[model samples]
Target chain A: MAELTYRDAVIRGIAQEMTRDPDVVFIGEDIGKAGGVFKATVGLYDQFGPVRVRDTPISEQAILGAAMGAAMTGLKPIAEIMFSDFIAVCFDYIANEFPKSRYMSNGQVKCPLVVRTGNGGGARFGAQHSQSVENWCMMIPGLKVVAPSSPRDVIGLMAAAVRDPDPVIFFEHKSLYATKGEVPDGEIVDTLGSAKIVRPGKDATILALALMVPRALAAAEKLKSEHGIDCEVIDVRSLVPLDTKTILGSLARTHRLFTVEENPRLCGWGAELVSIAADEAFYDLDGPPVRITTPHIPLPAADLLEDIALPSVERIAERVQRSLQS
Target chain B: MAKLEDRAPAPKGSLNDDIGEEKRLALYRTQVVIREAEQRAYDLFLQNLVKGTSHLSLGQEAVAAGFAGAMRPGDLSFCTYRGHAHTLARGVPIVQVLGELMGRDIGLMRGKGGSMHLTSVEHGVMGSYAIIGAHLPIACGAAWRAQYKGAKDVSVCFFGDGTTNIGAFHEALNFAAVWKLPVVFVCENNLYMEYTPISDVTAVKHPAADRAASYGLPRIVIDGNDADVVYRAAIEAYDKARAGGGPSLIECMTYRYSGHSRADPAKYRPEGELERWKERDPIKLYRERLRAFGVGEDAILRIDAEVKREVDEATEQCKAAAPPALDILTTDVYADGGFAWRN
Candidate 1:
């Protein structure tokens, strides 16, 4: 076993997949000679040469469009958009073309493409560079959205996305890149569309994703040690093909639920989770569901405002407490 | 108008007696096949036998026939919504296309993709998209794959004058030029993008062909009505792309005889536009050109009769087909079984 940061695990996962399959390649800005802006693709261009680790022009549309074409023709492409916000420029290629290709062709074609983007607010990079848009992608039907909160989950989920026959949006929380964790040395494959229970408890459940997972864990520990509120934490790894079964099962046992997301409340991923739980496990709910999400406004540039804009461990705990009271 | 003797060397290869009469006749026959198929489709639509709107390629048969003929079996093709001629030229069975228009289960897309979404992966026709300039990026993607894999195959992206103004068109062209990917952008400039003429919408002097020079890619403007001219240009473009000479854009200056979709009657067209385009009708020009090249009258009649019969047979097969079952609506959304069924 090796101790790897979430970013390092992603790089290793892509490198392994590229070495295993010649069809697998990486494309992004600064990924070639510069090793990516975040250095996640360091030393790949030299090892794989220019063909596999392409240094594309600054156009996000070009990077994504090339990946889509490559995926359609018979290559497993992992394209990295420097930041999640840059995806806005290529949304047409993603929402209109990639997802609709297979269905439009009646299963005659499959886009085995992976779009890896870094998101989440915490870094001093301000609003544009640090925003979570996983909810935007989750709204699309043909896409599979995966958000891994740990090094192990990132590596495993990335490998799965590379092998998946459909297009997948693999979101990496930029704030969680340096966070180290135990990652298996050998090949690890995790199932998409399934949630994993991080900590088990019967008093209440904390459903979270990506960077929010760590906050939820912190909140869970605080509730246990300080307030004596036994909390169950479930990491929702995949947002689009959400593992509702596991979430509902946890809710049934815990009888109370609170969701934490870095994105805003209105039309956010957390709202979807609440609605799903209401429809699937409403009878099991002991109280109305609560959500700890960023306010419905653009991420603030100021440090204090940024802190206020993001959901905190304290906020998650407060929501969990509120859920228990209801 | 200039006489035949005054014309230039016809681009590259000469259309002389050295080229066999049979080959020229075969090319004409292909054009006739597309024209007859589209005419029959229009007739069916008028009679309400086919449901949904269709953007007819009535005046642009040569562009599809010529380009598809130049492509190898493995070469990829991405076309716009006005793509019936392109699909038929790429060898999708006429019956399946007709069935799709009729909304039958046996349609090309199993009745999921209607008139605008005809796809036949078997023939390397990736699919046709209704979005104006969307397919250009996708075509670039396919071409990148071909080049990366060290394959000789090339991708042909066909769009219209309307699409050239969109952001995707410029983005795709720049990427294709920078990477030197093996792609050919075939812009079927039918003068108008639906109701708006190219002159009205574009600020550039020559539209797509002129824009190619700005991107440093080779451009060729051809009389789209002349099948032989269109065929020669396609051969040159395809050869350049396959030889790893990067990308080329061919502007087939053609016209549409129908409205943009099924609903409009094309009443907004200019007074003399239809008459001017009719003078350059591709089917008639090709038929006349074939006759001038010594294709006998009897052979031309035989080709016409054969194509008409084929279209009639396809229409009959389409009418006999059934609509897709209600359950089929949910399938094919995702490769893996993950979508929720609300019903």
Candidate 2:
């Protein structure tokens, strides 16, 4: 029952988890005294000491590999990679070792690790600092992918990520960090792999994730006000263990669907969702599902170019209108 | 050899106690076991009993046997492709190990893991990854788990001198050093990363041990052919790690007598190199040390007979063991009950 930003909520969730479990520690490049580049771990170093909130070298491979090592041994580690673009540097560790350890060992080892990184392109940090690579991670098995759009969802999903027995990739949108929302003061745990209904409607469904959730909601409101379109908005909080039940249920009611994502169009998370819908809810669909996503190009440094590159509320609304008309 | 005056004093409290008669005999027996087991595996490979390639740890027996003896049951171990000896040293049953190599259903990993993928979690041997330098990160992860769980256990990762050149090794070592993780990186410098000699690839004189200082970790170089020396060095490293003194890198200078895998005949080695290494045969040296320490010849003979009998029995069991059921091919790719995301 307190107003908090997405960054503050994440910091509170990590601090709460560290307090509850001494085994939970944080590690990243500037997460210690600097409190993280986005300040997601602000005031944690002072409260938990350097051992808990560790400052690591500027080696993403080492940070991720060490986090996997720590998680497999016994500690519940929440490692930060600063930006999602840097995740490419640690792909071998994540794809080859972390995901394969449990299955290769026949359930003898479990990697209860959470890799938290800032994603999406709004601040125009160019191609390197701003990118949404959640789809790249989704291709790997044994990993759970989560992207929360709001501060409340961030806190709830993060707590669940910390407690889950599997490795989780928690992507925080760079644009959503400063966005204010009402987060529950007491402990709140949202189940992973479950979608939440952000706006209930009957005409069509707009499924979104991370920074796109607010855009989807905005599009839904605009469609209702101007075009008299009743659009349902569903926040896909977790992408890997996707809440297919909730999505299909919503699709069953709406009979039309469109997915909105900040990542590029080709082979993006939207493609996966569309495939799943085609496979499971084909008969329920009245029209081919649409996808409103960023163009298949690197995020540009200029604000105008980046704005055009990312999915916009107007574009999402237009896509909803097209899906309904089709 | 350098003069005594010229040599630096062995790091204080680093040297282990002298290997007594019983320990020396034990070391000889373990080396023989490894040699015989590896030979039998090669024989099986020739007969098509084992599928895929086999990497023999024939000449490097002293390193595996010695370090394995120093480890407690709860300590963790990760090794490279040439890992049969390390697995045996970690107390994996000869019958199960041989069965795995033979691709039998009763084998470790339920016959899924072949010669290079051997694993025995019950014995604290996580796995032996086939990829060079891949398991270093895994070892670091396990060590991090140990420290996080507040367990006193230590993790030992065994790799070849060649793996030190890989990025994964550097990443694992740097993290272990920075976080002060309880891990010991044991590099079995067998003079070659496959057919290429260490000197040809690495500019540093001591390719394995010299790299430890780069990561701010204490380094030790030892005569890998000597079981007593390897055992002492490994024990010290493991002890320091378990005591929360952070990580250490130990380079065991040894030689591989056989080909890198089953494909090559090791023709690349220069004349007299193999002979020179054989002159320092660890099993023979330990046996002589045992005899000089008053262990009866009768006792040594009895021990050798016992080990031989065990190997013979394991071979028979492996040959008789049936191939894995075809249904297992679909299993173990994901955790049982299916992945939550997929199903």
Candidate 3:
């Protein structure tokens, strides 16, 4: 086992796929020689050269449009949007173009591509740059949305996303890039739409994704020791093809549900999960599902303000502990 | 009347002679088929057989015919919702095009895509994007793919005058120019942007041609009503792109006979505008040109008669075809052939 940062795992995952298939190409702004703005794609350009690892102008529409075009023809391209917030700039390609290509063409077109964007907050990049907008992509019907919390899951899920015969929105949290975890050597291929039970417990079920997964895990430990509540924490990795089986099974055992989210509270991904559980597993629930999320407001830039705005371990632990007691 | 040389982009060139009689006759036939098919499509729309809405390329057949004729078999063609002509020009069956317009099971996309998004990968008709300026970058990507694979095929993207103002148009042009991708952007400057004249809202007199300099591309404009002129221009652009000359932007001055869509009566059109453009009808000009070129009258008559028969047959087949099956509602939503989001 080797320890890898979440950022390095991104490079390894892309390199692994590009090495396996010559058809895989990468395109984005400053992603070639500059190694991306965040240094996530540090070594791809030197390895693949300019033809495969292309640097594009600051044109989001062109980046995704070209990617869609390439994918439609023959190439399996991995496009980067720099920041997930900028996905709004080229939302037409995400919302209308690639997603609708297959259905509109009656399966004559297949968009086997991945759009990797730096997502989430706590870095104090201000309102426009620091929003956790995974919910924005998840709401789109034809897109597969995945956000990995740990370094190991990052490589595994990214490999799965690239190999899938569809367009996937891979959201890498800006905060989690420096986080480290042990990844097994050699190939690490994982499945999409599968959730991992990070902390197994029977008292109550706590669900989270991306950065919130670790926070949820930490909160679960605190709740178990301090509040005498052994909570089951599941990392909901893929939002589109959600792992409802594991979540619902956990809910059945614990008879209580809680969702930790980094996105604004309105129409968050957790709301959909809560609705699904309410409808399908209403009898299995002991009380109304509780959601611990950032309030519906623009993310602040101040260190204290941003840190408090985002759901932290203390906030999640307190909320779950209080909700379960009530 | 004035000679073809007087109006062509290359006023003094021997390139016209190289087009050959065989290709000229084929281009004429393609324009005739597009013209006949468009008229039948209008007729069906009038009878309420073509449901929803359609954007017709009534007077823009030459642009589709010329470009599609110039493209190789594996070469890709991307255009806007005004795409029936482009689809047929790429050799997609008239019956399937009509079937799609009428929302039939035998349509190009089996009625799922309806009239706007006509696509036939087998025929190299990539897609008909309804959104303006959206497919320009997509065509660049296709060209980039060919360049990556070291292939010689070029991607030809077509759009109307209104598309020039969209951000994607500028982004795609600059992107293609910077990357030196093998693609040709054809702007069918029909002088109108929906109901308003394109000149009214556009900064320059010529929307696409004038903006070519901004992207470091040559400004090549031609008379779109002349199929021979458009054909030669397309060949030149495609040849340059195939020879690793990078992207080229050619603005073809054509006109649309119908409104922006079936919903508009085109009341915004100035008086005598439609009549003035009709004088230079592509089919009429091509027929006269074919006669002038000494193509026998019998051959021209045969193509016209055959095209008329084909349109009638396609119309009948479309009328008899049924609506798509209900089970198709959930199919093709994902690559897995199922719409299930959770399991």
Per DockQ, the best of the predicted structures is 3
Q: DockQ, per-model, please?
A: 0.60, 0.42, 0.88
Please give me the DockQ of candidate 2 compared with the native complex.
0.42
True contacts kept of each: 0.67, 0.46, 0.81
Q: Kindly list the per-residue Cα lDDT of model 2 for residues B1-343, writing each as its tens digit.
A: 1111233222323113365555666677788889888888888888888888889998899999888888887998888879899998887888888888887877886666678878888898888888788788778767877776788888899999999888888878888898788898889988998889888999786777788899897557888877877887877888889989998888888889898999989999999999998887777766665655566789888887888888899999888888888876554434443455743
Better of 1 and 2 by lDDT: 1
Judged by TM-score, which candidate is best?
Answer: 3
Q: Model 3 over residues B96-184: C-alpha lDDT tens digits?
A: 99999998999999998988899999999999999889999999999999999999999999999999999999999999999999999
The share of true interface contacts that also appear in candidate 1 amounts to 0.67
- Misplaced by over 4 Å in model 2 are B1-17, B144-150, B325-337
Compare the candidates by lDDT and give the number of the best one: 3
Can you write out model 1's per-residue Cα lDDT over A1-326, one digit (the tens) per residue? 98999888888888888888999988888899998888788888888999888887787877887788889889999999999999998898778888887887778877899999999899868778888999889888789899999999988899899998889999999999889999878887887888999999999888999999999999999888878899999999998777888888898999988889899878888788789888888899988888888998888888888988898988888777766754
Q: Spell out the clash pairs found in candidate 1.
A: A69-B141
Error of 1 at A61 (Å): 2.3
lDDT of 3 by residue, A81-177 (tens): 9999999999999999988899999999899899999999988899999988888888877889999999899899989999999999999999999
| Tens-digit lDDT track of model 2 for A1-326 | 99999999889889878888998989899999999999888899999998788898787877887787677667889999999998898887668777777766556666888999999889989999999999988889888889999988888898999998888999999999999999877888888888899999998888999989999999999999989999899998898788888988999999998999888888988898899899999999988889899988888999999988888998888878866765
Task: Please give each candidate's TM-score.
Answer: 0.96, 0.93, 0.98
